[model samples]
Target: NIIQNVLSPFKPLPDVVHRITAFAGSGKTHTLRLLASAYPSLKILYLTFNRDDDPLASEKDNKGFPSNVVRQTTCSIARKETQAMGNFEEPRKKVVRDFLERRLGHSLNYKVVDVVLGTANAWMMSSDPELSEEHVRKGEVCELKPEFRALDFVKLAKALYDAMIDPHCHEISMTHSTYLKKFVLSGAEITCKSGGPFDAILLDEAQDVNMVTLQMLLAQPG
Candidate 1:
């Protein structure tokens, strides 16, 4: 027993949370490159908020980035997860039509439906559920016209949620944040069976992350 215990390799310590802060033009990207070069074996998730900045645009441009590193925007991550989970039906138009028809017992023109959907998307992205509901109930969604207030924000929120989780649906059209929020709320395990996909996750433009994104990140094993 003593020999076996002595010979057994020690388990590595759990990773701790890391926060890297720097000013504009600082070497944040450089720092990440250095870390990637130093730890070639480590599986890394490098997330950025900039949709235009493809981290892997050019291997020569990102010379130090290891092959094990996976780079993506938070929205892209959410999109991929949604695609992997199931066939989520595209419900942008259906959600608006159903909510208006079922709740208000009224049919709206295509233009009105479009406006309502745009408003719903904005609310879902904002993360201020309570205030959004209150404003909707108070008929405050449109300041220029009270007729637009016929749409109930609460019902609209529910409609969006229902459309996202509908088993028979085939494609998800909701925003990335909405999909991520739904995925997390559905009790899906964020960490893999072997702990997680990566040894460390690097988030760029962290300030742009919404509550749902932050929660998703926090759910991952450090």
Candidate 2:
């Protein structure tokens, strides 16, 4: 029975978004770690609740990152090699807003594309206008649909599943819809391109994502 279940090839549902619901300490993070490790090139973005009082607490707490030595893996090494050109706070916020507005703008010369639609993008989009505008101007325009359509729960779910199944596909832009009190996805589309485009994108804490975030991921072309 154990062998059978282990060997069982579970056929995923059409456009199925693999959602693993696990109890606390149920190895959810562990599973992600395994997947990321197996695919060395995979870029994963993890967004956890503000469990820490200090945002930069982790940086201070894990003096040498010995605690996350196991989970960080090659991902951390790559991060070290490609630390942000400067601080990423401003740029990240801009990306988030541009993602939400559904408008693509050019920063340098490359294009800013959306691989997935998620709340993070929405939250960022709605949070600050100036920052969002800067992101669009700095980044290239993503090839989003002509009309800015809001993504519902169902559509968001489909987008998530689509991103996970593709190898060429990378990047997950999620938005947090808590502060502004928005639930569904809504926004307008803008166009622009970047000087240097991104290579990959990853989203962690997929469960906590909202509709807006999921829509950003769906904005990507399969």
Candidate 3:
């Protein structure tokens, strides 16, 4: 059924979003592969949570994407976009150490720095443009009483958010979550090497995507 629907040759594809939804074990990938073959020249963006679905990786035996197709996870896009702004995790840790030790005059141990950075990252995953107390409360991946630890994780998370957001304070690269969030807010589109937008976007496992990430992908400017 899907094969006939999507693989019909010489069919005029309307310039609009074409969504394909079906239950598990369905021939979704098979159909998509057929669609790509039908129109080999179209640039398509294929998104999925499973690494196996990514055609770029050569290690796996899965059906890889065609040369005209680009596969990316939401996290990969975020990190790629802000790579210049936020170098790497280890370097980010060193920057955090300097900030705590010099600018704030508060010496944070390695473990505490990890916890704070982790918490800040969690907050970035949220839909909020700016970090808030409520977001901190929601961002906690761990379940613990408020007064259980010697280190105040929520407060530290806020401090880290402030520093990251304020470019004038110091130079700390932007986090993936922050950069991804900004990408959505800015309403930008992913373009091709020839400076043209993608012909279409294929989002697999759409049910698992968060509201903010989904919004960001769907709201891209043509």
Candidate 4:
């Protein structure tokens, strides 16, 4: 039963995106370890969603690593890349709240700003600006408090992106999704200075990764 359910599907991987879905305790980490051990020469970037759940840390403590292996939480990688090119900051909750309050030209609850940022981040990660506007007009996007329109959300996102690029005021602290969105949108080159262009990128617990992170992975040259 174990062979059929788990081991059988763990055949040799091809050079493409391979998604493995299974219930917990299905030996996903074991499979990843096997891949890491097998290909010692290939530069592999292993990513996980939670820093506490990093498999590479456990592996290093237990069995050590090959010379070329790199491991990080997805957010860590995004922040590292963003910092490498220029000065960057993650936006604080208060700053975001104040920005939204001013943009809407009225006071807003802190929770409202949180919701707006969450919705706007998800929208930016998944859809282009034009399509997002279309979806907003079509009533596809979620409605927010004070009857904020789609254009309002779009403008807010653009403002955030602008803040990220501002040279004098590098005060925008960004979430992982926002950072990735800005990284790609700015036409910034992803280089090997941070240990990339890896021959194989292994993502354990990949189900937890968001679309923006996935796009960042796909942006890597195969």
The prediction achieving the highest TM-score against the true structure is 4
- Structural similarity to truth (TM-score) of each candidate: 0.62, 0.30, 0.58, 0.67
Residue 14, candidate 2: C-alpha displacement in angstroms:
13
Ten contiguous residues minimizing lDDT sum, candidate 2: 183-192
Is candidate 1 or 4 superior in TM-score? 4
Q: By TM-score, how accurate is candidate 3?
A: 0.58
In model 1, the Cα lDDT at residue 105 comes to 73
- 2 or 4, greater by lDDT: 4
Question: Scored by Cα lDDT, where does model 1 land?
Answer: 0.58
lDDT of 1 by residue, 1-222 (tens): 663353233212245556677788797776666655555676777877643336556546665567867777665566556653433334567655665666567765555555555555555555343325542423335543556555565666556556555656544345555676665565454433356557767777687777767767667765
RMSD, model 1, all Cα superposed? Answer: 8.4
- How does residue 32 of candidate 2 score in lDDT? 46
Which digits, one per residue and each the tens of the lDDT, describe model 2 over residues 1-222? 663453233222233345556687675555544444344442333333332323234453333222212222212222232221222222243443343344234232112224223322443444332222232321212344324222232333244433322334334322222211122122321111332211222344566544434554434322
lDDT of 4 by residue, 75-194 (tens): 666656556343234467788877777767877665555555555565656625332443233233344444544346556656765665455655565455566665655555444546
Write the candidate numbers in order of decreasing lDDT. Answer: 3, 4, 1, 2
Given candidate 4, what's the lDDT at residue 184?
Answer: 57
Q: Write out the backbone clash pairs for model 1.
A: 88-171, 89-169, 89-170, 89-171, 90-171
The candidate 3 region of ten consecutive residues with least summed lDDT is 139-148
Error of 2 at 36 (Å): 0.2
Go through the candidates in order and give the C-alpha RMSD of each one to the true structure.
8.4, 16.4, 6.0, 5.3
